[model samples]
Target: MTRLPPVPWTARADLAELVAALGPGNLRWVGGAVRDTLLGQPVKDVDAATPLLPEEVQHRLAATGLRSVPTGIAHGTITAVLAEGPVEVTTLRRDVATDGRHATVAFATEWRDDAARRDFTINALYADPVTLEISDYFGGLADLADRRVRFIGDPAERIREDHLRILRYYRFQARFGAELDPAAEAACAELAPTLKGLSRERVAAELLNLLGLSDPASTVARMDKAGVLPIALPERTPDGISLLSQVIAWEQAHAIAPDPLRRLAALLPADVRLADGAAARLRLSTAQRKRLSKAAGRGGDDAMDARALAYRLGMAEALDQMALTGGDPAPIVGWTVPAFPLKGGAIIARGIQAGPDVARILRMAEDRWVAEGFPDAGRATQLLEASIADAKIA
Candidate 1:
């Protein structure tokens, strides 16, 4: 038995009973939670596999006073929610058919068949929920130790099973894969165009996941090298890889978390219209699209220094713009933006009405105050007075 991090939710009686109800030697932790534990990383989602089918798994969970959510019942997955957290219970299975996006699977009793159907070896690792002993049916443990990501069987066969695996290969490479597998790379390149056949939502989600890695420049370059990027992002090129490399290094130096939109912005042309097109193609959420556009637009403007950016754009967007432009972030990391002294009320007090005219006066005053190096009270008052005078003249 291997000593592993404690599975937190196991302390709950409901979850403990659910584990027990599945019978001894039946339930085992699987997928990311298992793989990440072996790598000494924090686990976010807890998943497990059992030999019992979905209905059986649901029955067992219901016996423990736990409700079962048939999240993907047809695919043999049931999500059981306990007070601690939700655990996804999936019966061991093999893919019956796939069309790049959806897979038809049949439940199987043996773990190795299920492991063989997974996208990469490392992801196929399973663990004893109590003992923490890992089950490595396809040498996944060795590949995990080597930081290599290899398809379980023939690379082309796996690629044909689902073309999205090509992107997933790149995504895993960005996160845990230390180097590209030659056979997998060749297969991915040959089948890259099939990526366009996938739903825009799925490709967009995967791309964001790929870009959100601590550093993904090398993997992104590999994706481009395989001619996979242009197929998904029609107008994008590999030219921005070096720029992205610099941006990522600056992020690490400043202790910044990876921002997917910012990284994606780095890979796009420095034009807002082009970025907008990319966002539309990727079907980005409105908030994400707005942020990406703003970052791309401001990243190249040299006039907005660190403080001004933080003042106008807020810290998160400001820092994103900083990294995307390769600007020094140290100066702004701890700096606070000075507030403007004037507002619409102050303009109204200057004899202007409380309508658009007052708003216009305040806007003019604020711009002048910013342009005058963010002046003190005396200078702000002077600028306000000047703006009022100009408004009167007009």
Candidate 2:
């Protein structure tokens, strides 16, 4: 009888009270919380499985003076807001029908049925709240011990149920698996086109999560070879894998933290149109879209310093360009960009009237300021006067 070791979240008073209200043996710790705990990783989101339906779960929660939110009532899930954080309690579910993107599910009385519907074996493990005993329906413990990310049943069948699992397979394997499951890999490759039908938001979320890993180069290469990359990200070049490898190496060598968007930029060619298209397909936020477009390539001279690049583009995007281009980021690592000091008003105060000429003179002053290595406000005043004099002379 493998039992969950004593963990802080399992001992939370609010969580315990909620469990008591739900009934001693009715609810059990399940999914990522149990898996992460068994792997000795810090659990972030605590999820539980229960036999009680959503309404009954809510009624029980109300009796305990705890507020329940029907976060996913249609799918038989209710969120219990606890002092520690939110713990989601969902009823055991069996898929009534699936359309590769969304599933129609029905509450089930059997825990194995719920576990069976899950995508991966390792994620199906459950733990009793009171006894802390683990329930492995499909050799989840064995698979976890082996560091293998195998599907619950048939790989292709699981993928047909939800196309997003294709990306998830690679992500989980990248994060946790020692090697790819051949059947899973083959199924993913054959069904790669199915991912095209999924919502771009779903594809974007999973792709970003995969890129956020410590080093996803090998996994990405696998995805590229398996015909998954072309469908998931159409902007990638043939040499995208090599570029991604270089970027990851630079990040590790320079001790820079892994950033998902920057890594995605590495996989793309130095073409803004393609980058923007990819951003649009991914449904990235407006700011993120702009950053991706700007990071398509370096904007200025090849000999441009990090500070100059940082000045042109914002800090974060500058770092992306440097990392992608194999430049050292240490120069601007903690350097706060000095403000240009001279605004249009300051230029006008120097006797330049408010006109196109004033704007032009302000530009000249700013150019000189940047060219002079971003000096102090005093230097800016001197430069403004010099520029005004130069403008009158011109």
Candidate 3:
């Protein structure tokens, strides 16, 4: 018999106290904490499920002098702030009704009901923190041991509850390197069309998370094959996917961290207009749009001008463009960019007359300065004087 692992209560006093306060029957550690612990992976968030209702949860935590914030009271979730970390405790819930986007849930006393309501078996495991007993209602342990991501019960029914689960199913596989359950894939293929109805923010988050994991290229390629990728990014191209594979290879070669937008830029239709359209569809922020724009913009010989462009358009953007265009980011990052030695005043003092023309002349000179490997101050002055002489003759 595979008994549940004992939680280290002494190590995490806040968790111990929170569970103790809620009493044994009301509190059990659930979700990632239990799953990751079993997998021998680092666990960041502590999630718990409880039989206690929202109001009673508030009352009990308050009585213990612990702060309880109603982060998702309607979902029966209250976050207890403590020195250890915020432990999110949600009452066991059963879905009463669900659209493709949101679920109308009612609190439940039975743990199996809550487990059944979840999307994947691996995610539905629960553990009693006190008793050190693991609960695997939907054969989550068997699935986890086999490294297969199976939907709980019927695939179509589960996906019908929420369309985002189609993306999530792949994302989960990407993280765990698990093979997709065939039925789930077919079901996802059928329900893939409903992805458009979900909020862009939700879709964006799932895509990014999927992209953040290891070897996302294969998973994303599989999604594209399944007709899921086209729904999420209509501008996606086969040629772009080919480029994405190379981009990911370069990222690995250079030890670059996973960048979803840069990778997305690679998978876009090689046009800024299409990039903007895709970015808009994802509801990317202004900064994100600008970054994506710079990356997806028409190719430039950025190898020579990377340093100069770094100052003009942040190092990150320049480096992103450089990498997106298959240039090495190593040298670009270390390249010491020099500031333009000539200011507007210097151009004005040249008797070139002060106006937009002066600004334009100064800009032209600056371009020359950048082109000429950022000349010395004496050389720059000579260039400025010569330009002024030319201006007088005109």
Please write out the lDDT profile of model 2 over residues 1-394, one tens digit for every residue.
Answer: 8999999988889888888999878999999999999999999999999999999999999998889899999999899988889999999999999999889998899999999999999999999988899999999999889999999999999999999999999999998899568999999999999998999999999999999999889999999999999999988989889988998998899888999999999888789998999999899999999988888855454677889778978899888888888888898988998788878988666565788998888888888888888989999889988888888743
Task: Residues 319-375, candidate 3: write the lDDT tens digits.
Answer: 677767777677566677677788989976756667887877777777767777778
Span of 10 residues, lowest total lDDT, candidate 1: 1-10
Local distance difference test scores for all models: 0.82, 0.90, 0.82
Can you write out model 1's per-residue Cα lDDT over 88-173, one digit (the tens) per residue? 89999988888766788888989899899988998888878677788888888888888899998998888888888888898888
How high is each candidate's TM-score?
A: 0.89, 0.96, 0.89
Better of 1 and 2 by lDDT: 2
Query: Per the 3 Å backbone cut-off, how many clashing residue pairs does candidate 2 have?
Result: 0
Off by over 4 Å in 1: 1-15, 334-343, 369-386
Q: Could you tell me which 10 consecutive residues in candidate 3 have the lowest summed lDDT? A: 1-10
